[model samples]
Target chain A: MAKKILIKKASGEKEIFSIIKLKKSMMSSGVASGVAKRVISQIRPKIKPGTTTAQIHRLAFDLLKSEDKSYAARYNLKKAIMRLGPDGFPFEKYFAALLEEQGYETKTNVIVRGKCISHEVDVIAEKYEKNIHAIIEAKFHSHGGGKTGSKDALYTYARFLDIKEAWNIKKNKGAKPREATLQSWLVTNTKVTGEVKIYCGCVGIKAIGWDYASEGDNLQELIENRGLYPITVLISLNHQQVRDLLHHNIVLCKQLINQDTLLSRLGFHGRQIQQLYQEINKLFGS
Target chain B: MAKKILIKKASGEKEIFSIIKLKKSMMSSGVASGVAKRVISQIRPKIKPGTTTAQIHRLAFDLLKSEDKSYAARYNLKKAIMRLGPDGFPFEKYFAALLEEQGYETKTNVIVRGKCISHEVDVIAEKYEKNIHAIIEAKFHSHGGGKTGSKDALYTYARFLDIKEAWNIKKNKGAKPREATLQSWLVTNTKVTGEVKIYCGCVGIKAIGWDYASEGDNLQELIENRGLYPITVLISLNHQQVRDLLHHNIVLCKQLINQDTLLSRLGFHGRQIQQLYQEINKLFGS
Candidate 1:
């Protein structure tokens, strides 16, 4: 009998390596199914008994990079997002900005009174024209193996009900009943479970996760469609550089590429600034 | 001019020592004005420039102990309460027990929904016959200098309004309007500002503090009247021992005096257990 080949997970647990799982992930990045199968087959023979999932990811990433750089960038989205935080504030800032681009006035780290208590809302977005207001809970996973599960959806739903009750009371007190509409969304940098998706849908709570959107508009699709790639996704930038960019609220790659002054303001010298610009163009422009 | 005597505060700041303030505090502890004045005069010559307020407190405490040990115990009430925590959980437990003694069914750390939001109430007490429900917020100050201020009063008022709104909504939905009456109380282990008392009184929110009381029933008065003293008041036991006792829910000194099995359960051996028993009797019996 052949010895079982295992891959070490981010959590230090080991699992049997699956070529199908690797192929599905690559396919999600818009890589052709044939290309994904070819990449996984080529990488499979190179996997050692003690090889880590990170090592396997690197192997697949390199193969995709050599074949097609844009696909490799898209494939690296989850890993790049995982690097965004030791804290969730940066992701909340990025999510707020994404909402802003969609014609909503956005606020992050807001304390709003609920019907029974006060809550520190992560991101709040409002569109006056559409009479739409959304309270968003942004969950950022700092590790590849982490997930936003069903419990998070349930908790978000409870919080939403509280906020919705406050809105209803306020409306009845002075404003028209239909003057404004309130909604709650749970946005995560990692994928959510199928159970979470089902629960959220049943409760009318919108959930946006990496590759786990209800209407084919996941976090990656939303960002890529708007050219609002986070600065953390830049190939040339290190984690520290990305963190510094996030600290200055320069979250989007487009925000950095459009402003030379902003780059200088971040204390980046001429050579480093030039490299960042070139990398941004190559990754985003193509 | 004579050099002014300074006293160190719990916040590590120094202020001019005031005899009038000392007298007022002692009077609040049930010390007669004449006795308080005599105690101050005896300690006056002993107080030196740069002497810490803690030292002055010790001098007065010794004088009170010699004159009347019960008054000394009452005077030490604030310090004993401060020893209840590095966190406020123990104080909440004690407060819940205190409410139970007052003929109210009590629940601690309860999540109750209001008309506008959900509130995690620290202590909820209900007198079934009277249909009176009181939501109590227990503010434990680990340091003597800490205070429950006007801002706390304002926040508590807002929470009260939310809970009251929920009650009204529930009453309108199905229950009779007079089925239940709701009230909110702020209970703290330190002094509250006059502003807080005034604001609370104006809004019908009950404010209870170590010395500040809305209806002449401060925390000390309530505990002393009911003979419900927290085990943290025992000078014989160290902070860790008090914390361990509180961990097992052995809050009152009276409870410790009655339970031999409970003491052994807390890992207290012969000598230490005897000392605790003796100290409890000396403090409570006098």
Candidate 2:
């Protein structure tokens, strides 16, 4: 009924401010509906043309923190996902785990054979019974300010086509199962450019970014849907602790909860552990 | 034969120190054969297994400079190529000029149409009589440290394929000449990896780095063969002067020499201008 506010994104692109998207994120953060509405009402008057999404986020975060600090931490999921990488290995491993949960046998950091040459694949995920096989390329840009675009999509597809040709040859030679359908996937922590989506679609590559919707949930939604919140999502865990936890391969809060002893090795004291458990329970458990 | 000395290249790869390569570079620098042989003999005792190419370059360069100052500038051709870029437009223009010397009608920074999207092509070179139409992709690294690899080859090929498909469609409709063969050309100021050469070969793309040979003289050899050395090759010019000269589209030393009035605009006084002309004459002519 009103003119939609244009908000500047971290990548310097303008996006329409959607109350529906905001409320969904708030609800996912465990904010009560009443509080989300109240926050939106407070934020409404401040909304003007060219107000940055970052400024809106800070305003929402401060408001959420005042209401519930733990909820505010949950709201900072996207930022925490960014903390999982500088080198991108942690993000790759975490995404591999997510695929593993979806009944795919996943391997991280694989050297896969291609038609042209050898390719260092990030994640090779296969579901034998369903005849679904995939090589997933994970691109993790730390801080999430950069947009992933067609170059990434194109190169990943280039690698995919090379490998796919080899796979087809292997299948004909009886090296691979005839029924296996090989697919290429590109996953990124950053938002996808429009060109990326178009290019990926044109090439029959399934691409997923934090905001790119291919056939299913984007990375953020997938995390929420699967309850596979990364240990980085815990605001109380500092950079060192998160690094140490990922070093032990305890990526998800779900995995860390099962291995309580691992938290001590990460320098979490008894009280801190109790608080983490409480936060984890609130975020994931009943 | 003595054990071939291992030298670390700028890309951190170990290479065999070739006397032939050194000699050829010296010959190109206008150094006499007797002097080149003497310089090599003097430098041989200093050569260690793990000596960097940078050190060897310095050794050879000092020897050449002692022999002739103007010749040293020509010997530093590769380094001059590096100075032609921070933004890369100068190198692109310089390269376009080199192509034009070969009788190719060239345009720089043209936005070309593709099937799926439009591409901002660096250089479009056409020789209608030969039915050779090309879109040249130029990659200019300010420092000659990074290695151009398969990713560049693959992505450049990808863009080429997209545009090539569109060109075919246009040709079918008689929009383009039926006999015109669309070629994709990638040129870079850095050394290309073996993988890039291999990949480009497989994809039918002509990739030429400073050293990656694709059936013709690479960028350095092409520049020398054409006598179209960049004005950056002039040691008398400072960084600001080079930038200003490039801004005015005076890319080649030959171009700059013809426009002597432009030298005064770049703050080179009468004596300095005469010296520059002498250096240019020595580098290009008898």
Candidate 3:
């Protein structure tokens, strides 16, 4: 029998190491499949019997950084987005901006009356050309260990049903009837359970989570393809500094690179501002 | 072997029914040991092979109501307090009032600085006569099925440690220090896990919940002895009505009983107000 190598998780649980899982994660960061396999093989030999997952991640990240710095940053997407919150407002705003980049007009914190009650939607995306409207429930986990589960999916689906019923009622009442197709999409900054994925599939609701994707457009793809990295992704700033930036709605690193005065407005002074600029350039520079 | 009878739980899981558990629940409602045993014996035969715990609760509630209406209300105390919240603000206010009734000067939503951070305490009680100060973290679950777990207890203790450290620092700095003992209490409207109870006992942090008590003064004893029933206890009002009342800080039934205009201010119509008055009189009348 092959030796069972264990990888320690952040939560102190241990699981058997899987090279396949590692390769898939690398490929999701936009690395070519061939390079992903090569990188995995290179790191596999270095993995000891009881290697921590964090150490393995560091090894893979170093290789990816050497190969392509941007891809390395993209690989760290989950952790970066997590730093945007103790509250999920920043994540919602960033998600809206990502949708906006894809030619969708987006509104955050939109409240609409459902049949029995009012629903506060995290992000509402409208594609006028396609006449497509999506009420998005953005479930953000502030820490990496937390997974969005079936309970959240059930809650989101129920809300969608209510709003859909309300919409039909309004149409029948001849209150601003329009030819837009409405659908519900659950978006999260972390992975979701297999149960949630299956539930969404059965119900015709869309789910976009860290690793769970539909139509090849998961959160990782949406973020990396647009190069819209949150400001927390930068290694230069501390946790409090990142939180301060998020509080000011200065979400993306590209926003910081483009707007010089933004840092001063957020009360970043002297050496801190200079340090942040250097880190941004190093991470985002080709 | 005695026949195994299953009792369905709130979360839809079923377990073998234990008469001991049922008897304990009855005794916690202030029923005498002999009467509790009699009630248990009476209901034992009525319980079918696979009856739900909720059905058993209803049976006991009916029996208690017939025996003594106030005891019935006290039996429903946990559920009533849960109805006081979709948010915990109302419970905090009610808790503060309960402390006041015990001759303690109380404040809610008090923010005090810690060693490294600031903590927003749910309730702070100070008995000036005894020179005792207690910081309370009141965890209010909006549903009966929810539990206060070790995680919350741990978090509360950590916060208390931080504040205690800050307090020591202040005392050392000659910040007008008085010699008053500081202690932490974790109070909840739901039952806590055994792990939490054990942890609290070991650490000298007081844990008080619906059924979980320290030194015999559990949530049930406190509320019943003081006659501080939250307005949510009234069966006459719907969930939304209870929520609205809580939102306006009309927590206690006595508040509504005392002020006739309060119900009108809360937008309760003539018939609904009359119904509320009748229910209040039935529950709290001398």
TM-scores, in order shown? 0.63, 0.88, 0.49
How does chain A of every candidate compare to the true chain A by TM-score? 0.84, 0.88, 0.81
In candidate 3, position A185 carries an lDDT of 95
Ten contiguous residues minimizing lDDT sum, candidate 2 chain B: B256-265
Task: In candidate 3, list every pair of residues with a backbone clash.
Answer: none
**Order of quality (lDDT):** 2, 1, 3
DockQ of 1: 0.06
Task: Give DockQ per model, in order.
Answer: 0.06, 0.53, 0.02
lDDT of 3 at B150: 58
Residue-wise C-alpha lDDT for candidate 2, range A1-286, written one tens digit per residue: 9888888888799999999888888887678899999888888889898998888888888898787666777788888888888889999999998888889899999998777767889999999999888999898898757889888887898788888888989888988678788999999998998988887877788989997778898998788877888888786678888888899888888887755677776678999898888778877645
iRMSD per model?
A: 11.3, 1.3, 16.4
Say what the interface RMSD of candidate 3 is. Answer: 16.4
What would you estimate as the lDDT of candidate 3?
A: 0.78
Residue-by-residue lDDT tens digits, candidate 3, B17-126: 99989888877766768777767778999987679888898888888767765557767777778767678988899888788878999989998876645668999999
What would the per-residue lDDT of candidate 1 be over residues A1-286, giving only the tens digit for each residue? 4467987987689998887788988997778898998898899889888899999889989998888766677778777777777788888998898889989999999998776556679999889888878899898888787778755765676567767888898888887647778988989998898767776776677889987776558998888777677777666677677777777888877788667787778778899888777777766655
Best by DockQ: 2
Residue-level lDDT tens digits of model 3 in A180-236: 768889999888888677767766779999867765688877887778888776766
Off by over 4 Å in 2: A1-9, A12-28, A36-69, A264-268, B1-9, B12-24, B37-63, B265-267
